[model samples]
Target: MVAETTLRPADLIAPLFVREGVTSPVPISSLPGVSQLDLASLRSEVAQLVSVGVRSVILFGIPLKKDPIGSGASDPDGIVQVAIRELRQCFGEEIVILADLCLDEYTDHGHCGVLTPTGEVHNDDTLVRYQEVALAQAAAGVDLVAPSGMMDGQVGA
Candidate 1:
């Protein structure tokens, strides 16, 4: 006899992009059906997911500002952090919330971490930013934090 297993909505993880300062949802060309959502739109989208029995999501943030050190990534009121709080309040353990922890989108350089004077990535410096981001996400009550740092030995750092 063979045992059969099937995929279900509850096991799927939806990736949502939250962009700061957006009043309306903006389509992402690379992702045909996915859009960078404003906070209001984000709530709506997650609601639909819950209705469909989707129990988990991962969020990526696009902040309104970009600086050399990615200050917004660790800011308490940053887009992703704000989303985490809102979702937690509304969902309250009904769904799993994960934050995509990275600085690529928050930094003007668009690199995962800080760069050195010679334009090479400064690993130690970038890890500091990641630590701050992880802390902020934890404080916001995220269920999980996945680093998008794209660096070798990121966890060890």
Candidate 2:
């Protein structure tokens, strides 16, 4: 008899990237065999993942727009929000949906936090944006939010 491990398809989490503005999937050269998908393509990908016994997915959105404050990260109508809603509607809670809670993908400067006049990251100011992003992801029906920016007290904030 084969021993069964605790790990199962239910424990699998697929990571997905949603790129804003593009209507089709765009190749990500840095990550071979990966593409930044649009809404429609994302749906198709999710369907495929689920079909293959993957029960969950974590989303990272590449907004069509970015700003110093990472406004797109907190926008209710942003790419992640839209993707969350669509996934929920399609899977109807059968599939676990997660959102990446961070500022790097949404910040035009590519830093995880807001920068000061000295070009240094402002920690406290960035906490506010992280909080806002958490709330936004929750409101968008994300089952889980994972903050990857390594900011201090990000989970608490």
Pick the lDDT winner: 1
- Candidate 1 has its poorest 10 consecutive residues by lDDT at 148-157
Candidate No. with top TM-score: 1
Write model 2 residue lDDT over 1-157, tens digit each, in one string.
9997798777888989999899899999999989999999999999998888998999999999888878999999999999999999988888999898888878889989888989888989999989998999999899999989888888889
How does candidate 2 score on lDDT?
0.91
Instruction: Name the TM-score of candidate 2.
Output: 0.94
Candidate 1, superposed: residue stretches over 4 Å from native: 1-3
Candidate 1 C-alpha error for residue 147, in Å: 1.1
Tens digits of per-residue lDDT for model 1 on 1-157? Answer: 9999999999999999999998999999998988999999999999999999998999999999999889999999999999999999999999999999889999999989899999988888888788889999999999999987887667765
Q: Whole-model lDDT, candidate 1?
A: 0.93
Residue-level error in angstroms, candidate 2, position 61? 0.6
As a whole number from 0 to 100, the lDDT of residue 67 in candidate 1 is 95
